[model samples]
Target: MTLAKAAAEVRERAWVPYSRFKVGAAIRAASGKVYAGCNVENVAYPEGTCAEAGAIAAMCAGGDYKIAEVYVIADSPEPVPCCGGCRQKIAEFAGPDVRVTMATTDGKEKTVTVAELLPGVFSAAHMDRA
Candidate 1:
């Protein structure tokens, strides 16, 4: 499925009973494989993971670490882009110019790159390799 369709499908199946705020995310890996995920919220919010996180986990579990594109969906009037944490995660795999598509419940979509979404983002490149 396309990024938009995958994210939409994931959103339709998000598990956010507590927050009643569902979210969906889809990412295209360097392998040209598309992965989709839905928010799985727990009663203990801290235990919950974002849709992007889930997608990354799924891809990693399948031996994919490179991301090419990403799409997010949320039922809100305003643009529901990926969170700061999610942005960092995406940066680990997605390129600085990787495309990120965010869509709101109102059908409005915002497209940008990782740099546009998270300027001056931190990454492993800053760390010392032992």
Candidate 2:
């Protein structure tokens, strides 16, 4: 299926009871495989991660380190960009030019590159040896 379709499909499964805010993400890897994930929330709040992060984690588990494209869908009118943590997680697998798309339930959409989303991003490469 297409990235948009996958994202929407995942969005339908989001488990958000507290805020009733649902979001979904679809990640395409260099291998031409796509993984879909929906946000899973916990009552603990901060413990919950975005659907993008979950998708990236699943992709990493399968040894795919190159995200070709990433799409996110949310229920809001404005496009919801990945959080700081998710952006860092995305950088761990995708390249600087990795495609990132954001969409709202109202059909509004926007596309950006990973580097564009997180300019001057800090990565593990910046870490020094102990």
Candidate 3:
């Protein structure tokens, strides 16, 4: 299924009780497999899981570490962007040019690359001893 559809479907299962703001994410792994996730909120405020992070976790659990494309959907006035931490997490598994599509439930969408999402992203190369 398409990333958009996958994300939209999973969004319905979000465990959001505090803000009632549900979000969903889907990733197309380099293995050509699609993984989907939904945001899970908790009463602890910041302890909740983000949709993008959950999708990445699912991808890793499925044995695919590389992300080719990503889609995120939410109910909002405009396409919702990933949080700063999710952007960094995505940059870790996706190349600079990987496409990230953010969309609103009403059909509005905005596309950007991994590089655009997190410029000067910190990577393993930065820790190389060479």
Candidate 4:
């Protein structure tokens, strides 16, 4: 199954009682394994887990530190790109050229690279230079 489809499928499992906005994410690890996650919102607000973050955590738990590609899906009029935190997280696990696919539940889709999502990302390389 495609990454977008995987994201959409997992979206059904999201725990979003407040905003009722469900989001899903899928990441392809360098090890060729696909990890998927859904947003889990909490009542406290601002303490919810993003779908992309959850997916990355799963990838890490699976022992994969590199992301080959990513897909995010949400039920909106346009494709929903990752938030700022997720954009940075993507840059952490993927190279600048890694493809990030953003999609709407109704089939609208857009593709951008990690660098496009977050230009001049603060990565470990920059830290190493310090």
lDDT of 3: 0.98
Task: Please report, in order, the local distance difference test score of every candidate based on alpha carbons.
Answer: 0.90, 0.90, 0.98, 0.93
- For model 1, which pairs clash? none
* Candidate 3 runs further than 4 Å off: none
Deviation of model 1 at 57, angstroms: 0.8
Per-residue alpha-carbon lDDT of candidate 1 for residues 5-110, written as tens digits (9 for 90 to 100): 8888888999888999999999999998889999998887589999999999988988899999999989998878788899999998888999999998678999
Residue 113 accuracy (lDDT) in model 3: 98
TM-score of candidate 3 against the unseen true structure = 0.98
Model 1, CA-based lDDT: 0.90
Cα distance off (Å), candidate 3, residue 87: 0.3
Q: Least accurate stretch of 10 residues (summed lDDT) in model 2? A: 45-54
Greater TM-score among 2 and 4 belongs to 4
Q: Give the CA lDDT, 0 to 100, for residue 15 in model 1.
A: 84
lDDT of 4 by residue, 12-104 (tens): 999999999999999999989999999999989899999999999999999999999999999999998899999998898999999999999
Tens digit of per-residue lDDT, candidate 3, span 12-32: 999998999999999999999
- Each model's Cα RMSD: 1.5, 1.5, 0.7, 1.0
How many clashes (backbone N, Cα, C below 3 Å) per candidate?
Answer: 0, 0, 0, 0
Q: How many clashes show up in model 4?
A: 0
TM-scores of the models, in the given order?
0.93, 0.93, 0.98, 0.96
Highest TM-score scorer = 3
